[model samples]
Target: MWLLFLLVAAVAAVFSCARVCRAAVAAARTGRPARPPAPAPAPDPAGDDGHAPGLTLYEMAYLSGGPQRLADVVLVLMAQKRRLLLAHTGWATVVEPVAQDPVERATLSAIGPDGQRPIPAVREALVADEAVRAVADKLVADGLALPAAARPGIRSGIRQVWAAALLVVLTAAAAYWMAPPGTDTALLLGWFSLPLVLCLGTLAVARFELHPYRDWATDEGEQRLPGKADPPGSRLPSAPLAPLTSLISLALHGPSALTDPALRAALHSSGA
Candidate 1:
């Protein structure tokens, strides 16, 4: 009975591992840039408010930095406007009852009705805020962000590798049980080493390939946003508006893209 179980488990492990390997490969292929560049999107007409209609600060942040970037921008704006005080310990305290803009208002709302909250909690709150949702919806509509369904499918495929690993363990256990008395259990476990190694290798490759796409933006957003220049006057050295452009730059290029060391430290400290 143990021998039959071992054989069946071995077969199952092989099948599951093969599926996982295929998924890893597919993910890697998707991670690569597509050939024959896509045409640039037509520019949206400017709104009377001086910004493009339907393009919110949240969307810009999402395109550049993902959700954390959005939170970082909000928190920075709040701190700059003196609406909130952020400490190196990850605590945020509200100093002003009013917000300067929609993004700032969303941050204040995420900090909750109370005057104080942990930075992480505030970030989580911002993710669920209406402004964030609106920006995400707009991005999805504009094809700048992937639909919500796309992310879950990729994540589910990645999770299957761990499930396959469990099957490998079961195969080993069954093999050990079927072995004769005094037989080396290590040799039975060794039968699984190849599958284990393959599974781990697939995971590593997937992680490397998928890291850039793990955020909200789709291929379209990734191709277009990074090349955009910082708006005039927004890049000035030691300017009060420096944080605003810095936040946008951080979104486009990553945390290291920030010109201001203090802003980078603040983002790191806030877990943004």
Candidate 2:
């Protein structure tokens, strides 16, 4: 029984650790120019649900900023339109008290019925909302995003691998305590070490190879983003695209993208 469990655990540890490393590697690669998109994968029925036609400002925001970027973009839109107020002190107040879309509604929801919340708090809260998840889903369906099973920029898997390593250690200790008096426990522990070694070794290698990766697009997505300024669904000339263009800037560059002083303060330094 103990032998069987050890064998299973060893295989489990190897696969789980491999996944984390692969995600890190994929993240590193995705930051570079996207290669030509491969043949379209099967469509996710729930994805690409007309969030706007192909790759709108919101989509680009998700591509560049992930979920948090979505929050920032909405805040930018709302603030620009004078529908919401963001203070340098990190607080948000609704000005219009109305939402224009599901994403905006989600932001308003995060701010609560009291109509105010910290910018960071709202940003964090919105990350887990259905609307944010939908943006990600659309990306995946469009071949721009890696699926959840294969999504990158995650630290949770690392923690899970560590937990698995701990389990192996504890199981080995328990096995040793239950073994017959004459049994050679060292050899048994050595067998268990196979999985532990794999887990720890992968983590150590990752420390050197990995950085904080926020990119979520495939090579094709990366390739198409360069020199791209038109927001999705709008065919207007760059002149007419000015407002959205600034949004694209905010989406791609971040709060610093704007020249506005107060917005820079609210999105940048978190103080009153």
Candidate 3:
């Protein structure tokens, strides 16, 4: 009877989980299917190219706790002439403008050398600049630009380990107080299997994005006019040398310098 009860509970749990996952995915994709892969130099309307050279970056943050912690992503793109920030709700028609900031004349003067060059062209030039590429490669190697999964896994894994340790204690206590014969072995099995189940379940239902980039806020704040005291704890979120060098090169030489087709395609897709 106990075995039958456990089996029925397991089946019910699996069915419930499946229903929840399906509903979530349906809600996310309710509008149109995702747009086709955006090509480099995305189709541009006439009269949109007279602005200064622009570099736009996006960042998204997410959390996992069953379905309750899921949040729609917000995207913020900042560039030389203007900034466009927006969020997409679950439905197709739910896009909303978060804010837009026009560049000041002084800032524009500082950024200088306007262009219609595509972003891919810039990425290519950066990669080809032996001096720049060497710095970027070193930054990537030193964990500044590596994928986000590695560090988060260590942090979240520690949380799971602590939770599992507590669950084992609770399960043992309950079994000792009231479970029937052979329940000790069952409790041991549960202790060993429970964390695996919880971790996989969290992952299955979580909103996951690969290679999430950190915010540039830290780096921006650290930059001084070459003679100021270094701000405390002000470190670039990325490998300090490469991102700074690249941005400086772009700022100085303009977007004509680098050209990476893949990067171009991605920025174009983003409408950056």
The number of the candidate with the highest TM-score is 1
73, model 1: CA deviation in Å?
1.5
- The 10-residue segment of model 2 with minimum total lDDT is 43-52
lDDT of 2 by residue, 50-156 (tens): 22234556666677667877788888788887889988888899998777678889989999999988988898888899998987776676567655655533466
Rate residue 184 of model 2 by lDDT.
Answer: 79
Winner of 1 and 2 under TM-score: 1
Candidate with best lDDT: 2
Residue 65 miss distance in model 1 (angstroms): 5.0
For candidate 3, report its TM-score: 0.26
Question: What value of lDDT does candidate 1 attain over all alpha carbons?
Answer: 0.63
lDDT string for model 3 (137-190, tens) is 332332223222333443344344345445544444544455577665655556
lDDT of each: 0.63, 0.69, 0.29
| Model 3 residue 126 distance off true place after TM-score fit, in angstroms | 30
Per residue, candidate 1 scores C-alpha lDDT tens digits across 119-164 of 8888888877887777766666666665565565567766777777
Report the C-alpha displacement of residue 36, candidate 2, in angstroms: 15
